[model samples]
Target: MTKDWLTTGETAKMLGVSRQHVVDLCTRGELTFSQPGTHRRIRSSEVQRLATSEFTREQEKSLWLHRALLGPLMLDPARVLQIATENIARWKPLQRGDGMATRYLEQWDEVIESGVDAVADVFTSKDERSSELRQNTPFAGVLDDDERRQVLQSFREHRQREHAAV
Candidate 1:
């Protein structure tokens, strides 16, 4: 039988993020892990659940771009959350009949209320709910145009290099 737990590296590979990101998830209490000896061991089941929420290439690209907000989110979450809160309020009506999308938006509010760590989790999580909430993101103006442009350009360059290497 397959082992029921995974190493940080294994979890990262499954989530398409760095091992350190997996550690961060544990630190944020998003994923529970056991410390055996010196390494962190996460439940394989939890990792699989996250993996199942797989984003399309475009969604992954968007998420990668959003990683740029990690710093700002950590540094001044209050301002970032204020913008997101306003965005959510404004867009609620726009969602009209898209219940799933609206529900995600409401969830975003809860994540926002939960504080910085929770919001950060949403930005980095591979969970299906997180992915859905990302589509209805309330962070419309968190990043300035220059920061957004830089992140987009960097993502483009990275994708080009990835293709070239392949």
Candidate 2:
């Protein structure tokens, strides 16, 4: 039997996002929560339904872009990690915690710190936050300008093919 309520962490795992992302959802009024005391308790039904949530067009694009980084990341995890942390450090002091970028970067930083698997999950997961996380990814310089152009062309062609089929 399933319980009616689940903690943010549980919901985050179920949603394949950071626990903080679940908290952020609650904070943004996107997910209602019951705070019995210290932590937020979300409705299991609400979270379950969100699993079927549609990935928007922008989210789809971001997913594909992140996919471009995945191969290099997997081939040389240590170097990619170094690059990501360096990128994060460069962006950190400037954030001042005023915008969504700051918060998402923090989440991505935590994932990067957790090691390759965690970071890989963010890039490859078919979950909602993966797309959102990519928007604020600290994976700059993972690919060079030429690589970026190639990826952009491939993505454009893929989309064009999709549109043609539809």
Candidate 3:
């Protein structure tokens, strides 16, 4: 018996069984355990195994959605849409019948939802520097050569003055 042996209570709770049942499992060789003297202990991982439930449909759907849209939409949105549409068309109707198909549909839905929001979020979240400069800066395309030269000359003089001071 090792000191790390889980007590009967921990083992029972993990296996969703009574303390006696855990003892029985240990006795019957259905579950592996450790004992330190007369005391029993179950590993935390063993307990987690019994407590954890399989993923539900909604959870699977949400995960699929998040993963599908986790990349930039602009580079290949059409290809994305095409793949999504094809997969959805093939699987959406039979979603209840197959876990694999359900996953595909969920992923497509996630991609569309996330892609739209992501695009909007990125477009609206312009940095302060870009926003301020965009508003203040004149279009250089419209500037005559002389005007551009004057602006450049003024910038050079400003840089020289700052350097001299430094």
User: Best candidate per lDDT, number?
Assistant: 2
Q: Candidates 1 and 2: which is better by TM-score? A: 2
Q: How close is candidate 2 to the true structure, as a TM-score?
A: 0.65
List residue ranges in candidate 1 displaced over 4 A.
1-55
- Output the lDDT of residue 151, model 1: 89
lDDT digits (tens) for residues 24-83 of candidate 1: 668767678899798889999888765675445455766875688888888987888899
- The whole-model lDDT of each prediction reads 0.78, 0.80, 0.47
Worst 10 contiguous positions by lDDT, candidate 2: 53-62
Runs in model 2 with CA error above 4 Å? 1-53
Off by over 4 Å in 3: 1-5, 50-166
Q: After superposition, how far is residue 135 of candidate 2 from its true place, in Å?
A: 0.9
Better of 1 and 3 by TM-score: 1
RMSD of 3: 22.1
Give the per-residue lDDT digits (tens) of candidate 2, residues 27-96.
Answer: 8676878998897898888887676756544556667878888899889999988998888888988876
**Candidate maximizing TM-score:** 2
